[model samples]
Target: MRIRNSVIVITGAASGVGRATALHFARHRVSLVLASRRVEALEALVAECQALGSRAIAVPTDTSEYDDVRQLASRAVQEYGRIDIWVNNAAVSFFSPFLAVPMADFRRVIDVNVMGYVHGARVALERMQDQGAGVVVNVASIVGAVPQPYTSAYSVSKAAVRALGVSLGSELGLDRQKHIHVCTVLPPTIDTPFFQHAANYTGRRAVAMPPVYSPERVAKAILRLAERPRHELVVGRLGRSMVRQHRLMPGRMEKVMAHQVENTHLSKKQAADPSSGNLYAPSLDPATAQVTGGWKGRRRSARRTLAGAALLGVGVVVLADRLRTART
Candidate 1:
C-alpha cells in the first residue's frame, strides 16, 4: 500500500471530491490518470497536479460508456506500465420524487452513477487481476445506507455501489486474491458542486444538507484507504452517527430521514425551473470544476455544528428509548 510512486486512476477527476483527491495524491509523488467528460477541467487538473510534482494525464471519458472506461484503463497502463489503485468516483444525480421524475433522467442517473462504477470496477479489476495486486475505491454516500425522501434514484444507485463493493470483496476473498482489494467510502453531505450540477425536478433548488464536510476531508479518507484498504469507511462524524442510528432503528431512522430531506435537503425559499443540470452533458462553465461549492461560510459552519450536535443528541435519545422498550 505504499502510495509513493504508485499509479492511480481516478474517474470524475474534473471536480468536487475527485479533484480534491487528485491534488492530495499528487503531493505523494504518485502517477495519476484523471478522467471526466470535461476535457478543459481535466486538463486544468492535470496541470495543477503536475505543478504539485506528480506525473499526471487527463483522459476525457464518459464513464457510462463501457468502451470509454475500457480505453481509460488501457491508457493508464500504456502510460504508467501498471495500475496500483483505481478510484471510481464518477457519478451523476437528480433531485425528484420517485414518480415525478422523468424515466429518462432517472435511468441516466443509474447509468452514470451505478453502471459507471460498474464499468470502472470491471475494467480496473480486470487489469489488476493481471497485475495480481491493486486496490479499487468506490465512493458511495450515507444516503445509500439510509434512504432519503425525494432523490430516489440517487439513493438507489449509491446503495447499489455499496452492495457492489461488498460482493466484489467477498468474491476476491473466495478466490483467495489477498492482495486485491475493493473499498467503499460513505461520505455525508459534502461542500461540493454536486448540488448545483444535479438534475432537478422538485421545483426547488437543491442544497447540501447540514453538517456539510469539506471535500478535502473525503479526499483524506480516500488517501488513507489507498495506504491501508478497509472494507468500508464512513467520512464525517454526523455521517457515522446517522449510519449507526439507521442500524439500530430502521423504521424510526427512515422517518427522520424523510423529514430531514423534505425540510433541509432543498432550498425552501427558492424555486428552480426544471433543467437537466449535468446528467447528460458536462457543464461548460469553468466554475463547475472547482473543489469547493462556497458552502463553507463561517455562519453556516457554526449553524451546521449546532445542528449536527442536536441531531446526534436526538439519535442517542431514540436509541436509549428503544433499548428501554426491549428491556421492558
Candidate 2:
C-alpha cells in the first residue's frame, strides 16, 4: 500500500522504536496519530512531525485500557476519513527472577505489553474491516521466540503477541479479508530507552545487550512492513540467526540464551535499587523520550558483531556434528 496521504496510528510514540517510526513516517506524506502516556513528549513529537510537513496529532493514551484504545481509533477516523496503518508498539519490560518479582509488577508487564497490543489490534482491525483494507504491525521482541532468563513476564507477553498475530492472520484468511494484513516484527536488543525505562527488580542494572541495533533500524523495518505486509519479520541479522538456531536446537539454545542474558543483558558491576520504572506512570525525564539510548556505536557494534558471529558459528558446527552422529 502507498504510504503517502495515508492515515497511520502509532502507539508508544513518546520514545524508543515507536518514536523513531513516527518520525520516519513523518517524512512521507502521511497523517499520523501518535499515542503515548507522556502527554508532553507526544506534543513535542507532534510538533516535530508537523515541522516535517505531515499532518499529525498527539493523543495521550494508555493502550492497556480498551476504552482508551477505542477512543484512539475513533479519534483517528474523526481526524482522517479512514485508517490505513496501525502500529502496536507500546510495551513495558521488567527484569527480575520469576520468584523475585512482585505479582503486581509481573501482571503490569503483561497488562501493558500483551493486553496493550490486544486492545490496539481489536480496535484497529474492527475499523480496518469496515474500510476493507488496513495493516497492523505488531512490534514484538526476539525473546518471544528465544526466551531469556530474568525476564519471564516480558518473554511471556512477547510470545503471546506473536501468537496473537498468527491467530489474527488465520482468522482473517478464513474470512477472506485479503486486504487487511497483520504483521509481527521481532527485534533483538535495540538501542532504545526501553532498557532504562524498564522496571528492574534485579540487583544489577538492565542494559541493552551486545550487538544492539539502533531504534532507527527497527523503525525502518516497521515502515517496510507497513508498506508491504509480511507475517513475521526479524529486524536484525543476529536476531534472525538466533531464531534459526533456537528452532534447530531448542534445548541447547535455551541454555545459551540464559547465559547470554546473565552476562551481557544486565550489568555485572552496576548495582541498581528495585524500582518500577514507567510501568504505572509515564517517565518524567525528558531524556527517556528520545529515539536512541546511547548504546549503539560503530566500535561497539563491530566488536559485538564479531562475538555473535563466532558464537553462532560454533553452534552451527555442533548441530552439524550431532546430525552426523545421529545418522551414523
All candidates' TM-scores?
A: 0.97, 0.97
Query: Compared with the true structure, what per-residue lDDT tens digits does model 2 show for residues 1-328?
Result: 8999999999999998999999999999799999999999999999999999999999999998999999999999999988999999999988999999999999998998999999999999999999999999999999999999889999999999999999999999999999999999999888889989999989999988887788888889999998899999998778888898888888888887887888888898999999989999999999999998888732477856785886697687878999999999
Clash totals in order = 0, 0
For candidate 1, lDDT tens digit of each residue in 1-328? Answer: 9999999999999999999999999999999999999999999999999999999999999999999999999999999999999999999998987888899999999999999999999999998999999999999999999988888899999999999999999999999999999999999888989998999999999998887889998999999999999999999777888899788778887887888888888899999999889999999989889998878822367766787787677788887887999999
Q: Candidate 2 at residue 60, lDDT?
A: 91
Identify the candidate with maximal lDDT.
Answer: 1
Candidate 1 TM-score, C-alpha based? 0.97
Model 1 score (lDDT): 0.92
For candidate 2, which ten residues in a row score worst on lDDT? 296-305
Output the lDDT of residue 34, model 2.
Answer: 99
